[model samples]
Structures are given as structure tokens and as C-alpha cells.
Target: MNLEELREYCLSLPHVTEDMPFGEEILVFRICNRIFVLTNLERIPVSVSLKCDPERAIELREQYPDKIVAGYHLNKKHWNTVSLEGLPPTLIKEMIQHSYDQVLAKVPKKETLKFI
Candidate 1:
């Protein structure tokens, strides 16, 4: 997906909000005010960082070495940076959903997730 397409997908998630806390070029998406996905707007072919299960993160990197890698400027064990240059859009969407679910599961409020 393209930048606008990805932005639309992210904002469609319940309780998600976008911010440029780092700068105008960096777009961060948060749920319950906790960041889950980060995108570099200035970069071509979009680069996004998403939280992931530690073991799953390693597996993904090993499986998609050219497209997925250790998170940029994030805890290497819990996050991943995905290059959307040629990866499947469905895979990217799943990545975003996993990140959202991982964060939502830790929020201590199941009722809040019902709205999503």
C-alpha cells in the first residue's frame, strides 16, 4: 500500500491517533496514547516500525531478511522495522494488527477493546 493507503488503514483502527512527536516527517500511530506503529514519511516506499512478540520478531526477520529487520531506534527484541518496497500489502496489514493487539492486550481494560 501507499502512504495514504497505509495512513487510512491505521486511522481506521479503533482509538488510533497519529502524531509527529519526533518531527513532521515521522508519523506515529498510537492506541491509548501508547505508540504502536511509526512511519517515515520522507522516505520512499515507506518504512514502518511495529511492536512484535520477541520470538516472532526474530522469526520474521530471518524469514524476510530483505523486507523486515530489527526495529530502528527501538528495543530490538520487541519491535521490527518493515520496508514496504515490495512486500505484500496483506502482510503489512497483519503486522499492523499484531502490533495493535499486542499493545491493546496490555492496557488492563478488555471493555475498551470491545469498541474496536
Candidate 2:
């Protein structure tokens, strides 16, 4: 998907918001005030960094060298950069959900109940 589509998908999730805390060029999506997805608007190929399971992150990196890589400027063990070009839309959606779930999982029950 393109940047607009990606942005829309991220925003569609519960309690998700977009911010440019770093700059206008980098778009960050958060759930419960914690970041889960980041995109570089100025970059070609429209890539996004997403939170991923550690072992799955490594496997994805090896399996899709051209389309997936270690997260840029993020903890390598828990994040991944996914290329938007050729990957299936369903997979992208799943990754977005995973990122959202990861962030949601960290929120305390009190804070989470506020959103729910």
C-alpha cells in the first residue's frame, strides 16, 4: 500500500494517533501513547518500521532480505522495517495489528480501561 493507505490503516486501529515528535518527515503511530509504527515520508519505496516478536523478527529479516530488515533507529530485537512494495496487503495488516497488540499489551489495566 501507499503512504496514505498505510496511514489510514494505522489510524483505524483503536486509540491510535499520529505524531511528528521527531519531525515532519517522520510519521509515528501510537496506541495508548506508545509508538508501534513509524514511517519516513520523504523516502522512496514507502517503508515502515514495526514492532515484532524477537525471534520472528530475525526470521523475517532472513526470509525477505530485500523487503524486510532490522528496524531503523529502534531496538533491533523487537522491531522491523517492512517494505510496502511487493508484500501482501493482508500481511501488512497483520503486522500493523501485531504492533498495535504489542503496545496494548504494555499498557497497565487501569490506563487500558480508560481507552476501552
Candidate 3:
């Protein structure tokens, strides 16, 4: 998906917000102020970094060598850099959900209540 579509999808999730905390060129999507998705708006071949289950992350990397890889500047075992070309949109949406859920899971109950 394109950047606009990706941004809209992330925002469609409950309590998700887009911010430029780092800068205007890097779009970050957060839930409860915890980031789950990031994109470089200035780059061609739109891509996104997403959190993933450690084991699933490895599996995806092995399965989609060209489209998926270890996340840049993130824990390689738990995050992935996903290339948004030739990848199914449904799979991308599922990955986005996984990233969002992972971030939500880390939030303490009190903080999560604020989003709820």
C-alpha cells in the first residue's frame, strides 16, 4: 500500500495516533503513546517497520527474503522491516494488527485503561 493508505489503516485502529516526534519525514504510528509502526515518507518504494512475534519474525524473514528483513535500529528478533511491494495487503494488515497488539500488550493496565 501507499503511504496514505498505510497511514489511514494505522489510524483506523482504536486509539492509534500518528506523530512526527522524530521529524516530519518519519511518520510514527503509536497506540497509547507506544510506537508500533514507522515509515520514511521521503523514500521511494514505501516501507514500514513493525513489531512482530520473535519466532514469527524469523519465519517471515526466512520465507520472504526480499520483502522482509530485520528492522533498522530495532531488536532484530522482535521487529521487522517490511517492503510494501508484491506483498499481499491482507498479510500487511495482519502484520499491522500484530504490531499494534504487541505494543498494547506491553502497556500496563492503568495506561491501557486510558485508551479504552
Candidate 2 local lDDT, 11-107, one digit each (tens): 8997788999999999999887889999999999999999998988898899889999999989999999999999999989998899889888989
TM-score of each: 0.91, 0.95, 0.97
Candidate order (TM-score): 3, 2, 1
Candidate 1: C-alpha RMSD to true structure equals: 2.2
The digit string of per-residue lDDT tens for model 3 on 5-66 reads 89889999998988898888999999999999999888779889999999999999999999
| TM-score of candidate 2 against the unseen true structure | 0.95
**Alpha-carbon shift of residue 104 in model 1 (angstroms):** 0.9
Write the residue-wise lDDT of candidate 1 on 1-116 in tens digits: 88888899999998898999999999999998889999999988688999999999999999999999999999999999999878989999999999999988887676555544
Better of 2 and 3 by TM-score: 3
With a 3 Å backbone cut-off (N, CA, C), the pairs that clash in candidate 1 are none
Question: Candidate 2's error at 62, in angstroms?
Answer: 1.8
Residue 90 of model 1 has an lDDT of 96
**Predicted structure 2: lDDT:** 0.91
Candidate 2, position 72, lDDT? 90
Q: Give me the runs in candidate 1 sitting further than 4 Å from their true place.
A: 110-116
